[model samples]
Target chain A: MELILSIAIGTLTASGVWLLLRPRTFQVIIGLSLLSYAVNLFIFGMGRLRMDAAPILEGAGSDPANYADPVPQALVLTAIVIGFAMTALFLVVLLAARGLTGTDHVDGRER
Target chain B: MGALFDHLIAVPILLPLLAGALMVIVDDRRRPFKIAVNLVSTLTLLIVAITLLMIAGGMTASGDPARTSVYLLGNWPAPFAITLVLDRLSALMLVLTSVLAVAALIFSLARWHRAGPHFHTLFQFLLVGINGAFLTGDLFNLFVFFEVMLAASYGLVLHGSGTARVRAGLHYIAINLSASLLFLIGVALIYGVTGTLNMADLAARVGDASAENRVILEAGAAILGIAFLVKSGMWPLGFWLPTAYTAAAAPVAAIFAIMSKVGVYVVLRLSLLVFGPEAGDSAGFGAHWILVGGMVTIGFGMIGVLASQGLSRIAGYSVLVSSGTLLAVIGYGTAPVISGALYYLVSSTLTISAFFLLIELVERARDAGADVLAVTMEAFGEDEAEDAEEEVGVTIPFTLAVLGASFAGIALLLAGLPPLSGFLAKFAMIHGMFNPTGLGDGLPIGAGTWVLVALLIVSGLAALIAMTRSGISIFWASIERTVPSVRVIEVLPVLGLLGLCLAMTLQGGAVIRYMDETAASLSEPAGYIESVLTAERVARAPSGTPDPAQGADEETEVAP
Candidate 1:
C-alpha cells in the first residue's frame, strides 16, 4: 500500500512540474491542479496508510494507537477544499487574462 | 488575564473575518454604508490592537508573564486543539498590520474603492489572513491563513484590472500557488516525521527525532524555507515582485508591504524556535543557507533598484532589499541583531508603503504622453527632442513641491539617511552586530557579518541613486504638465505613514527597548513552548503532573 501510494504521488508530482514549466496558461492551471492532488495525497499518507481502523476512540480505555490518526485526515480534507477553490480562481483569472491580452501565453504575449 | 480578555487573543483574527463576511452581504451600490462599516471596523481593530499590545507589554490583570499568552480554542488542552498564541512579537505584528490596514483603507477612500466590486470585503479578508498567520500556533493553521491571505490578495491585485495588472497578477498567482503546494508538501513531510503540526510541539519533537527521521525532517524544513523565501522576495525566487508591485493599485501595494514580511516573520519564528541552539546536531541547520541566500538577494535587489526605470519598480526592488537585510540579519541569529531587525522591519515597511502610495500621486500630474515618451526613451536608450527649445527654470509648483518633499523623505528613509528611523534602525543593527558587550552568544565577528554590513550600506546607496534619478525625472525634468489636482485625503495618508516613521525615529529609545525584550523572549523558545503546552492545563488544574486529559501515552498521542 505504501509503495503504491508513493509511486502515485511521485508520478503526479512529476507530471505537475512538467506542465508547470510550460508556457501556456492552461498548462499551468492543469499543473497546479495536479500538484495540489499530489500534495493532498501526501498529506493523507502522513497518517501512515491507516486502514480498517476508526479514528474515534471506541472507549475511554481504548489504546489510542489502535485507532487511525484523524488529524492528517482533517488537514487533507481542508487542503482538498482549498485546492479546489484555488483551481477555480486560477481558471477564472486565466480566462480573463486570455480575453484581455488576446493570447493564452503565460506572459500574455507571443515569444 | 481574565477569561474575557483571554478571548482577545482571537479577536484580531475574528473581527476582520466577521466584518469581511458582513461587508460582502451589503449591497455594493451603497458607498456610504460600505465606507461607514469599513471605518468602524478598522477603528475597532486599531483599538483592539492597542489593547493587545498593552496586554502583551505586561498590563494583564492577573500579572501573567508579558512574553507569552495562549488562548486555546473551545477550551481544549494545548496539543489537541487549535491555539492562538499572543506574545510580544505577535501583538507587535498585529499592531503593525492594523496601522497599515487603516492607513491603506483611508487612502483607498480617496478613489480606489470604486475600482472594483467587494473591495472592502477582500480587504477585510486579507487582514483576517494576515492576523491569523501571525497568531496561529501551528503549521497547518499557518498554511490555511497563508492561503486565505493569498486568495484575497489575488482579488485585490486584480481589483483595478488593466492589461499590466492582469499580466502581473497571473505571474503572482501562479508563483504563489506553486509555493503553496510546496508549503503543503513540507507540512505533510514534517508531520509524517514529527507527528505533530503545532509549532511548539514540533519544536519539542524535532530535537528528539531519530537519525533516520532527521534527514526527512531537515528536507521538509528546507522545502518549507524555500516557500517562505519565495514569499519573502529572496533573489532568484523574487523576479516576479517588481512587476507585480508596480502593477498593483496604490492601496493594494501599500498593504502588501507587510505581506512579504509575513514570510520573514515565519522564517524567524520557525528557525530560531525549532532549529535554534537547543536542536543539538541540527542546531543552525539552515542558517548559513539563509545568510548566503539573503546576501545574494540583497545584491540582486541593489542591481534591480539601480536598473529599474520607474518609481514603482524602484519601490518594489526596495522591498527586496529590505527583505534581504532582514533575512540575512536573522541568519546571524543573535538577539540584539534581531531586535534591531525588528525595529528595521517596522521602519522599512512604513517607508516602502509610503513610497508606493506616494508614487501614484506623484505620477498623476505628469503629462500622459510625455510619461509614455520618457518610458520609451528609458527602455530603448533613445534620446529624442534633445535640440528642442529650452524652457526657463522656475520655482517648483505646489504639487511638485509636495511630491518632492515626500520623495525626499522616502529616499531618506529607504537610503538610511540621518535624522530618520531608517538610519536609526540600520545603525542599531550595525551597532548590535559589533556590540562590544558580547552578551549574546558572543560569537566572534565573522566574514559573513562583514559581508552583510557591506551589502546593507551598498543597498542604501543604491536606493538613494534610484530614488534621486526617478524623483528628478518625474518632478524636475518633465516640462509639459498640469499641477495634479491633489486631494487632502490622498495626501494625508502618505504624510501619516511618513510621520509615523518620523515618530519612530523620535521615539526610537522606547521602541528599541520593547523590541529588545521581544527578541530576548523569542531567543528563548522554552517559555513559548511551555506557555503554549501548559497554559490551558495550568488554568484548569494547578497541579502539573498526570492531568486527566494527558494520558500515559503522551508520546503516542503526540506521535502516531
Candidate 2:
C-alpha cells in the first residue's frame, strides 16, 4: 500500500515541479494544483491505509472495533475547499493580468 | 461563567470581523464614519489590552511561581475545537498587535483619502487576520486567517497607485500565496499522522510515535518550518521580504509588523506544544536546525541591512535579522531562550514598524513643496526626528520623537543592552544553554552556547552600524525638498505606538515573567494534547462521518 502511494506521490511531485518551473503563468497555476493534489493524497495516506472500516463507532457491538481515523479527512476536506478558492483567485488574477498587461509570462511582468 | 469567558475569548477576532463588515457598509469618506471606525479601533485596542492584562494577572498565580493564562474558544475546550489559547506569550503578542493596529488606523484617517480604494475596509480586514492568527489554537484556522490578511494586504500594499508599488505587491502576493499553500500541505500531513488538528492535542498524540512515524512527522515539521521561515524572512526563504516591505506605504508597512510574528507564533507554538522536551525525550531528537537557520538568517539580514541604501529597506532588513535571532533562540530548546526570543520579537516588531513610518515621513519631507518646514530643522533634529508630535507638514513631533526613541531602543534591545528586557531575555537563554542541569545530556550544549553568543555579538555590531546609517539617511542627508508633515488623524497612532514600545521597555521585568510562565506552559505537551484530543476524539467516533483521526494517522504514515 505504501509503495503504490509512494510512486503516485513521486509522479505527482515530479510533474508538478516541472509545471511550476515552466515559463507560462497558466502552467504555473496548473503545477500548483497538481502539487497540492499530491500533497493532499500523501497527507491522507499518512493515516495508514485502513480500507473497508467505516470510521463510525458501534455503541453496543464491541469495545474495540476497527475504524478509520477521520480527523485528517475532515481537515483535508477543508483544505481542498480553501485550495480551490485560492487557485480560483489566482486564476482570476491571471486573467486580469492577461487583460490589463497583455502578457502571461510566469513572472507576470517585465522583470 | 465559563461560557461568558469563552465568549470573551471571541472579542479580539470579533472586533475586526464586525469592523470589516461595517466599513464595507459605511462605504463613504465622511469623517464621522471614520471617527466611528477609529473609536471601534480604540475600543478594540482597549479590549486587547484588557485581555493581555487579564492573562498577565492570571499568570502571577499559575503553574510557574511567575504567571500564566490560556483561553480556549467557544467552550470547545483547549485541544479539540479551535482554542483562543491566550497564554502569556499570545496575550503579549495580542496586545502589541492591537496597539499597533489602533496606532496605524489613527495615522490613516486623513491619509485614507490619499490611499485610493477601500483603504479603511482593507485595513480592517487585515486586522481580522492578524487578531485571528494571534489568538487561534488550531493550525487550519491559522492558515485561513493568514490568507485573509494576505488577501487584504495585497490591496493595501498597492493602495496608492504606482508602477513600483504594483510590481512589489505582485511579488509579495505570489510569495505569501506559495507560503500559504505550503502551510496547508504541512498541516494536512500532521493531521494524517497525529489524527488531530488541535495544537494541544497534536502535542499529546505525537509524543508516542514510532521511529518511522517520527521521521514522517519531522518531514512535515520541516516543510512547515520552511513556510514560516519565508514569512519570518529566513535567509534563502525570505529573499523577497525586504523588497516587499520597503516598497509599501508608511501606514501599510506599519501593519506588516504583525506579519512576521505569525511565523514566529507558529514556531513558538510548535516548540512549546508539539515539539517540547517530551517529544524530544520520546524520539531522541531536538530542534537543532532552527537555531542554525536563525543564526544564518541574522548574519544574512545584517549584511543586507548594511548593503541597502534606502531607510525603509534597511529597517526591513532589521526586521528580518531580528526574526532570525528569535528563531535561533527558539531552536536552542531551552525555556529561557524562548522567552528571550519572545521579547526580541515584540521589540523588533515595534522598532522596525516605527522606522517604516518615520522613513516615509523623511521621504515625504524630501518630496515636499516649499511651504513645508525649515529644511535643516525638519531635515534632522536627530532627537526630535522621533519624539515630537507636532509637524508643519511633518508627522507629529512627538511621534517623530517616539519613532526616534524606538529606533534607538531597537539597537539597545537587539544588542541585548543593560536596562532593557532584551538583555534579560538573552541572559536567561544563555544560562539555560550553557548550564548542565538545564539542557542536561548528549545534546551539543557547549557548542550551541558559543554559537548563540557569537550570533549575539555579530548581530549587535551589525545593528550598531545599520542603525546609525538609517538615522542619518532618514533624518539627515538633505534630500532637496521641504519638510514632511502628519495629518491630524495620524499622530496619535504613531505616537501612541512609540509610547507603548517604551512602556514595554519600562515594564521589562513584568514582561519576561509573563513569558516565563507561558514558556513553562508551552513546555508541557501532555496538558495541551490531553486538553483537546481524547474527549473530542471519543465523541466524534460515534457519528460515523469517519473521525479526523484517520487524517491524523496519515501524519504518522509520512513519519519515516
Candidate 3:
C-alpha cells in the first residue's frame, strides 16, 4: 500500500512539474494545481502509514498509535482551501490577460 | 475593555482591521478625513508597538521569559487550542511593523492619495496582515495574514490604474499567489506530522522525531523556505523583485520595502529555532547554506544596480542587494550574526525607502517619464512644453544629497564602516566569532579569522564600488538636464524620509542593542518554547516524554 501511494505521488509530481515548465498559461496553472496536490498528499503520508482506525474514538476503540495522525490531515484541509483560493484568483487574472492581450502564453507574448 | 487590554497581543491586528472597515465609509472627496484616519490608525499602531516592545524588554531581562505572557483567544489554552505568543522576536518585529507603518502612513498622505479613494483603506488593511503575520502563533493564521497583505498590495500596486502598473502588478501577484500555494502545502505537511499548530509546542516536538518524521519535517521546511525565499528575493528565486519594485508607485514602493524583510526574518527565524542543533542535533541542519544563498542574492542585486540606468530601477536593485546582505548575515545563524542582520535590515530598509521616495522627486523635476529614464528623456525632449507650467517642487536640491546618503548607508553602515551603527553591529558579530568572553565557538584564532576578516573587507569594497556606480548613473549623469519648477507637497515627504535615515545612522547604538537581543532570543529557542508550553509541560513523564513536535511549530513561527 505504501509503495503504491509513493509511486502515485511521484507520478503526480513529475507530471505537474512538466506542466509547470510549459509556456502555455493554462498549462502552468494546471501544473501548479497538480504539484500542490502531490505535495499535500506527500505531507499527509509523512505522518507514517496507518491501517488501524480513525483518530477519534466516538464508536470504535482509539489509541494514539492506532489513529493516523489527524493533525496533518487538519493542516492539509486548510492548505486545500487556501490553494483553491489562490488558483481561482490566478485563473481569473489569467483569463483577463487573455481577453486583453489575445494571448494565453505565460510570458505574455506570442511565440 | 479590561479583557481586551489583557489580550494586548491581538490589538495590533484588531486595530488595523477596525480602521480599514471604518475608512471605507469615509467620503472619498474629503481628503482631511482620509488623512486623519490614516494618522490615528497608524498612531495607534505605534502606541501598541511601543507597549509590545516594553513587554519584550521586560521578558529579555527576566531571562526565564516563559512566565512572561501567553494569551489565547476565547480564553483557550495552548496545544489543544490556537495560541498567540509574544516573546522577544515577535515583540521586536511588532515594534518595527508599527514604526514603518506610521512612517509610511504619514508619507503617503501626500504620496499615495493621488491614486484614489480607497488608498488609505488598503494601506490599513495591509498593515493588519503584516502585524498579524508577526503575532500569529499558528501556520494557518500566517497564511491568512499573508493573503490580507497580498490582496491589499495588488490594489496598491495598481492603485493609479495605469496600463503599465496593472501589467506589472499582475505579474507580481501571479508569482506571489504560487508561493502562497506552496506555503499552504508546507503547513499541511507539518500539521499532518504533528498534531499541534502552536510554534512553542512544535519546537519541543520536532527535535524528538524519528528519522522518518524528520524527513517529513525537513520537506515541509524546504517548501516553506522556497516560498519565503521568493518573497525575500533570495538569489535565483527573486528574479521578479527588480521589475516589480521598480514598477510600483514610489510611496507604495517604500511600504513594500519592509515586505521582503518579512520573508528574510521568517526564513532565518525558522532555521535557527526549528532546525538548529539544539532542536534536531542535525549537524548539517541550520548550517551556512543560507548565507551562501544570501551572497548570491547580494551579487545579483549589485549586478542589477551596476547594469540598471534609471533612478527607479537602480533604487530597486539597491534594495535587492540589501536583502541579500541581510540574508547572508542571518544565514550565519549565530546570535551575534543575527543581531547584525537585524541592524542591517533596519538601516537598509530606511535608506532604500528614502531613496525610492526621492526618485519621484527626480522624476517630476526633470519631467522624466515614469517608466525608464531613457524613455522619459526621449518623451520630454520631443513633447510640447505642456508640463512647463507645473513646478517639480521641493525635492530637487536635496535629491543628490539623499541619494548619496542611501548608497553610503549600504556601503558604510551595512559594510561596517566605523562610527556608524552598521559598523558597530558588524563588530559585535565578528567579535562574537572570536569573543573569548562571550558564547561563540573559538574562531580560527589566527589564519582562518584573518581570512574571514579579509573577506569582509573585500565584500565591503565591492558594495562600495557598486554604490558608486549607482550614484554616478542615477544623479550625477542625470544632473546635466534643465530643472523645472518644484512643489512643496512632494518635497516634505522626501525630506522627512532623509531625516529619519540620518537619525538612524547617528543614533544607531540603542537600536543595535535591541536588535541584538532579538537575535539572541532566536539563537536559543529554549526561552520561546518554555514560555509557550509552561501551562501544560509539568505533566509529562518524569523520565522525560522526549518530544520533537515543539520544534515543528517553533520553526514555523519564524515571521517573514
Candidate number of the best DockQ: 1
DockQ of each: 0.60, 0.24, 0.34
Q: After aligning candidate 2 to the native by TM-score, how far in Å is the CA of B516 from where it should be?
A: 2.7
Which regions in candidate 1 have their CA more than 4 angstroms from the true location?
B59-65, B368-397, B436-444, B537-560
> How many angstroms is residue B14 displaced in model 1 relative to the true structure, after the best TM-score fit?
0.8
Q: What share of the true interface contacts does each candidate keep?
A: 0.80, 0.20, 0.28
The digit string of per-residue lDDT tens for model 3 on B277-392 reads 66655433634666778777767776676577676777777777777777776765667767766766766676677667666655654555544434423433332244334323
TM-score of the second chain, each candidate in turn, equals: 0.90, 0.82, 0.82
Docking class of 3: acceptable
CA lDDT of every candidate? 0.87, 0.68, 0.69
Model 1: reference contacts kept, as a fraction: 0.80
For each candidate in turn, the TM-score is: 0.91, 0.81, 0.81
lDDT of 2 by residue, B1-560 (tens): 24355456567777777877877877554646856785677566667566555744474234332233355443344566666655556677777777677666666654433346577778878877887887777788888888787778877876664445555665676677777767877776777667677777676677788778777777777778788888888787888888888767677888887788788887778766777666754432346777788888988988887787767777788788878888888777666666666766776677666667666555555543122223323332343444344334534555445555656765665566766555665666666566635545555647667977887777777777877776766555655744445554655564555565567778877877766666666676665555444332223446545545554556556665
Best by TM-score: 1
Instruction: Choose the strongest candidate by lDDT.
Output: 1
